[model samples]
Target: MNCYECVQQGRSEVAVAVCYVCGAAVCVDHVRAESKLLRGPASPGKVIRDWPARQLTCPVCRAAEESP
Candidate 1:
């Protein structure tokens, strides 16, 4: 699919990822990625490490998330 924001600005760009918040297809220029730390479940003698998770968002949704 094509980038929604790019289409709004009259540009044709391929979408790289979908926004997790609003489910909008976004290009690299319009996509925002936030890193999330994952915690594992409690277990006996289990070696757990911090896993990095990524959350994709569009410019509009990112702005909303940043707002108080």
Candidate 2:
């Protein structure tokens, strides 16, 4: 897909990441890196485990939105 921001800027650029919140495709220069928590299944008596994970988001969505 094409970069949304680049389209606005009157240029056609290849997308490197898609926004997790809005699903807008964006180029590397328009993407922001964010971390998400991943949960692992555990027994009821045991504590749930979580690990940091990565998600790519567009600049606009990254500013005012969250992934579900």
Candidate 3:
């Protein structure tokens, strides 16, 4: 089977569910998600950044990260 997101690579034997936000076709050994609060400097105003945890992401997802 092919990955629903990538539609290019064959699915792994233990493919994991994809993340709705990033559309990453993660495998059982690569799937991971978590919430984090990032605190920035106080000079420009303290900023709290909530983001998803990293995992063994696919090439497409990696590309997205690089672009952003």
Candidate 4:
């Protein structure tokens, strides 16, 4: 698939990943990676915090998220 952002700018760059939030295809230049901690069940009363997982999003979604 081609990058949504690149298409807007009249470029046809190959998409590397899809945005996790809005499902927009994005290339390396348009992809935003955000690390988030994942919580999982460990024991009966304990929760484990795993390593931060990467979440990809388009620039539009990222900007809206940061705004409010």
Best by lDDT: 1
Question: Between the candidate structures 2 and 4, which one is better when assessed by TM-score?
Answer: 4
Tens digit per residue, CA lDDT, model 2, 1-68? 89999999999999998888899999989999978899999998999999999988888877677545
Off by over 4 Å in 1: 42-50
Candidate 3 whole-model C-alpha lDDT, 0 to 1 = 0.53
TM-score of each: 0.82, 0.79, 0.33, 0.85
lDDT, ranked from best to worst: 1, 4, 2, 3
- Judged by whole-model lDDT over C-alpha atoms, candidate 4 comes out at 0.92
> Residue 47 in candidate 3 has what lDDT?
62
Candidate 1 lDDT, 1-68, residue by residue in tens: 99999999999999999999899999999998899998887688998877899999999999999999
Question: For model 3, how does the per-residue alpha-carbon lDDT over 1-68 read when each residue is reduced to its tens digit?
Answer: 33444444444344576755566555554544444554544555556555555545555565666694
Model 1 weakest lDDT span, ten residues long: 41-50
Q: Give one clash count per candidate, in the order shown.
A: 0, 0, 0, 0
| Candidate 3 residue 42 C-alpha distance from true site, Å | 16
Candidate 4 stretches greater than 4 Å from native: none
lDDT of each: 0.95, 0.90, 0.53, 0.92
Residue 22 displacement in candidate 4 (angstroms): 0.7
- Put the candidates in TM-score order, highest first: 4, 1, 2, 3
| Local lDDT at 35 for model 3 | 49
Clash count in backbone of candidate 1? 0
Clashing pairs in 1: none
